[model samples]
Target: MGDVSITVLDGDTLRSLHVSLREDTVSLTGAQVLDLAESEASRSLLGLSLPQHLKSSALRRMNIDGVDDDVDFRRKELSPEEASRKLNEYLSAIADELKDNPLVASNLDGSALRMLLEDEDDFAMIAENLFTDLDTEDKGMISKREIRNAVVNMGVEMGVPPLEEFPLINDILKKHGAEEEGELGQSQFAELLQPILQEVADALAKNHFAVIHNIKIVNGSELKKVLANEKKLNDVIAKIKQEKDNGKSGHKSTEIIKDFLEKNGKELGLPPSEANEAVILLYDAVFADIDSGKGASEEEDEFRKLVTEILEKFAEQLEANPIYCDLDG
Candidate 1:
């Protein structure tokens, strides 16, 4: 209605909210207020905070027509693959929306742009504030100067260094075919940025699958911590896979791995007591993958002996009473 005001009186505090609408004035209790807030019209006009009972009542009212039934049923029926595809489609739409704004397109570059493309929440936040420093007068478009200023503002907000120059923005424009004298429009900027964003999405998707596969192959979660960089994840996975063909396994290798694990175990997602044991288990799996039914190599045998010795040293911490091969059963 014309204006809706919600006033809540607690023991000593009074909270009030005012919203304007074309409907008539109405006085409603807190529950009624919540019910009214559920309607699309009410939400479009203003936000209201209501208690649980009223919120439930309002939700029931909104669904009284059964318009949401089919959508809810479909959501419940969606498979994991279907849900993932739908989410990707939604993310792609949001990424595309970013391209339609020249100031947003120009302001993003370097690590900031990479993160924006990869993180939907971060991208939305930046896009929401796109017009804060730029003027949209040239046929609803931003100029080169505005783009430069926007980039500097974005960089500063992101805590990036050296705001005195706009080299990153200039470089982005040039790469997107913006000439020194030519004009840059939102559409053109978005079109050029689309491919880069797509590449980022693709890389992220590939890395995600690769990480899952590698973790499964190793049958371990210890790698998750040290594999912070996708490139490093790829490298480590490759090395583990090629261990049979090119891997060096021996007392020296065991010593080196043991030292690495002991020093960086916490950072690698392994506890101090089990760090050496995790490396031993991982190497065993890797060696098994490479052996192809063959026996362990002489070097591998030596490494295994060292690992056994190391594990025996930590036997008290492991709490395992099983006898070693050298001990009588």
Candidate 2:
């Protein structure tokens, strides 16, 4: 097996995966990967027994020498069945080695997880395990709803998650999943997560958005596209900022940009659902500023406030709303 980072685009689709092993990285997507999140199958063909967490395409990373395939994986395509078989061989081998470690299975219950979640590292490990473990049928991606469901079930099974929290998490994840009509692919996901992650990141920054003038508005795939090998997106954002006068006086002007994105994003052949998601992404990112208590920077505050007001248009329309970002912030 090789070291790999699998990105679950949106909530259900497997957007991209880059594997790293011995300094060699091979990224794959679509049908290129096989058994990305397998539960159980063949085993006995791996060096490191992959725990359940590692089974997820998002977490499987191993060192395989003489396997530098980054360019090839992206430019080349593989037969679905062939890719599946080769990938399965690796997964089975890893699973067999870790068979005894049920803790390595989907229902991750181990002494280490219990102790670790309690520590200050903040159980960031839990987030890892949450996203990586339990692939259902070993597909490259796991549904956001499934992950939360696993937690609620496991919490009850292990006595960790409160009964009250179980329903709440279930409701939230379910609501999010339902809002998306079940699954989210890369673009849809970028619409939701970029803002949420940026907001979360901002919260970690001195507790608010005002503390930082320049913040990452997008993350995951959207970030990859706009910022990859270029800084065009930053130019777009900066151009908008320069024209603004800082507070309510200049706030109305941003609406034009928003109108442009909303209209051009639609007229130029992008999906309206995706545009809706983009709007929400802005909301979530600004929610970080709102929640920070310090508010946005002098120049950015009004723009953010306009964004805050725009969030109201989304209302209970879950797919268009920031979902967790609204309440969380």
Give lDDT tens digits, candidate 1, residues 1-329.
Answer: 00111222111111122223324433333233323323322232222222333323323434422447524533353343443333333223222221211010012123433555566665555544553335456454555444445445554334232333323445554554444444445554444444433443343333321100001112123333234455654444344324434544533444354454455444433344343455465445433433232233345445444433333333322222211111111
1-329: candidate 2 lDDT, tens digit per residue: 01111111131111122222222324444324533433222222111233334344322333331224433442455454445544555454344323211221111123323343345343444444444455545454555445444444344223223325223333444444533435533334334432332332232232211110111112222222333323554454555455444444434454544544554432222224244355566544534434343233454655544543433333323223222111112
Misplaced by over 4 Å in model 1 are 1-113, 136-138, 163-169, 178-329
Off by over 4 Å in 2: 1-220, 227-230, 242-248, 252-260, 264-297, 300-329
The lowest-lDDT stretch of 10 consecutive residues in candidate 1 is 208-217
Model 1 local distance difference test score: 0.35
For candidate 2, give the lDDT of residue 167.
36
Residue 165 error, candidate 1, Å:
6.3
How do all models score by TM-score?
A: 0.22, 0.21
